[model samples]
Target: MNDQAARLRRMIEDKHPRSDNKSNNIQENSKPEKLSANRGPRTIAITSGKGGVGKTNLTVNLAIALGNMGKRVIIIDADMGMANVDILLGTTSRINLMSLLESDVALEDVLLRGPYGVSYISGGSGMEHAMELTSTERDILFRKLAGCEEWADIILIDTGAGIGGNVLDFISAADEVLLITTPEPTALTDAYAVMKGYSSISDNPNLKLIVNRVIDEPEIREVVGTLSRTAERFLKISVECLGYIYDDQMMIKSVRQQVPVMAGYPESISSRCILSIAKGLLNGHQEKVKLGWRGFLKRIFRS
Candidate 1:
């Protein structure tokens, strides 16, 4: 291995030692992080029933916007099969979460930093094993992630489109879930299906809704109302109105520039809406870091 790889490997071995053998290593690494009251972060999963509903976009910008408002934020690209948050943010991550699970790497090693001072975990590929984490590993992962709650104010997980075990597992583990959808009929229908499924579960997630790429206020209310009414009448669950993002080409442009809308085009309506969403989630907000040379180094060299 190269110098950097060797150095990283040394760090891994120091912090989290390798198991007795390859099989044992797989079992040990697959185990989840342990939970402590002092865990470092609060995790929230952002999901959508269908693709092209702007769920990933909302996740990226909301994470950045939250960071701008002074909250320590980390985005977990939990969309296993088709992870692309790094691509959308224009970050070429050298490592990924899956690598950490498969090899002996610190979670920090796989994280990517983004605009507005946000940290993101790239959802890399080639880990079919991740689908079936051991019960011990699952517990260990959660415990370690929960430890993050001790440090981070918000941990946003961007789940893949559709309602599978992988996506559902992320949702179930989160403190809250933000479901995004567009005004299109198909999107609405699929979103409702997802909500219905959640409501049917005996242990459902704390669900919230956001309508993206909206045309106007009426569309926002209408879409939110549809999901709300269905939840009330059918699922018997309450869904909060997180807010909406208007149709703006600037969003696509900002993505092209590898910058969040909040920074790339701050004054845009979409950016304003995202800020409003962060405010609505006010109870979850925390104090921002005092950015300086010390803070910068601390974040870069988190121990």
Candidate 2:
């Protein structure tokens, strides 16, 4: 692991302070635990109520950060018409998730290898047509999606930003939802809107919030607290404040270079913030048994 990643592990120990159990065995000097083979991958749908909130940027970097901590990560560009995970990674793919639905294609053929051993499957209009598959085709596709658990300990789905049925389907199906938003009033409002739509569909929704481009601690607190309180008081739903990222110029440079900051600028403050979020995310859920891909697909098809 790089210095930034190592610092992140130490920072997590100082801040989160885990219990002294074999399962929670993350130490400052020792390596992070290898993902357990007994359980399935933890599938998290990363979405936003609106675009240009650094949703995709955060998704790409966070995956690499988590992978740095010894977790296998897979990203799915569920952005449909606006698919760009491959582009962000400076790679191109002719085949995608849709290939499986159209014929007897294997998942290996569609996966795109990103930096830091992170593999992603570009939705590339594949997600747009995923729901249109025939009964048999849909069954095959769902099974292929389920088999994704074999390739990852953590599966991050970058769903398109919106309140549309397609976006909500992926959000509701995943084991957890990480909603991204900025400090803009419109972004916050739309975040609420997405939460409202999601709450109506799933009686029990695991909605997590992450504020991007925050200028200070107070700003993040205001954004996260306001959203969490609003969801609980008005919509009768709870939203977890996963973490926040600071405004950093390195991020812009990384985007232009089509390289993730976690690798391109690991020492940047933004990268440190991302690593912190990754560590907290992993440690917090160590005890929880994630449902994995099969569970995610079951919910996806039912919805």
Candidate 3:
């Protein structure tokens, strides 16, 4: 843990210097010069301070939203110990991400394609396994994940809540983190705990705040403003407001129907809100350099 932290923290803090055209991490003369695709796919981990704040729901629907915009998306349900994603997606997969560690199945075999060509990979029990992979196993896993750039433009990890090492490893290493929370006092306090856990190791995390189930725009402003101010005051990290989801009954209806609200009812308020957030993320308007999939994976399993 200490070694990976020191290596990754140095990498993170030195990103700007490394982005220069003259300096390169590559030594192979046979390889082509860098292209935009070489920057790799964007990896965003969506998590919250506590459960029941609609984090997984937001993850599935948000993936659909990005897919609708012609972006290839992958949602990895990394919220350990629960299959909420499969239950929500109305999918029951015999092969999961854990299968990769336990067997020789290909990465494509592990993927469950959701709406609009968006793929899903249940973290299954493999999240715990992932955090403790052998060196060879880790190499195989990263090789497969690195291929994601060929097909995917965005990868969203529906991470577990709390300050567990598993959750912290993902959110801390991600290109950006979407910290989901509610206006409730308990939820807000829990949200801060997660942020503190992330800030502990990351040199400077690119975090965005999303307030779910907001009743009104005024409430949105208050919730985001308060959280952002608190983070800046104590953690000394800025949290950007990435928009909010409304308290819509349609979300519940879609869940019961086993379809994402974005796909089931495009006109719903919740769908519109998610689409807006997706657009903000897709347009590259966010003020942060994405750490990419390779970078995210490199920060894992070195403890």
The residue-by-residue lDDT of candidate 1 on 1-303, one tens digit each, is 233554565567558754443322113433323322222355577889998788778888888787777777777776765556776777666666556554445544455555456677666542224446655554444333332432366678788777864565556545667899999999988898888766665264478898999998888888998889988898888887878999999998988887878878989999999989988877644443323221211221231
TM-score, cand. 1 vs. native: 0.75
- Candidate 1 vs candidate 3: which has greater lDDT? 3
TM-score of each candidate? 0.75, 0.85, 0.84
lDDT of each residue in 142-167, candidate 3, tens digit only: 76665555446788999988877588
240: Cα error in model 1, Å: 2.2
lDDT, candidate 1, at 218: 86
Off by over 4 Å in 1: 1-40, 102-104, 125-128, 134-147, 202-204, 283-303
Listing every candidate in turn, what is its Cα RMSD in Å to the true structure after a full C-alpha superposition?
10.4, 10.9, 9.7
What stretches of model 3 exceed 4 Å from their correct place? 1-36, 284-289
Over 182-205, each residue of candidate 2 has an lDDT whose tens digit, in order, gives: 999999999999999999887568
Clashing pairs in model 3, backbone N/Cα/C closer than 3 A: none
Q: Candidate 2: deviation at residue 119, Å? A: 0.1
- The lDDT of model 1 is 0.66
Better of 2 and 3 by TM-score: 2
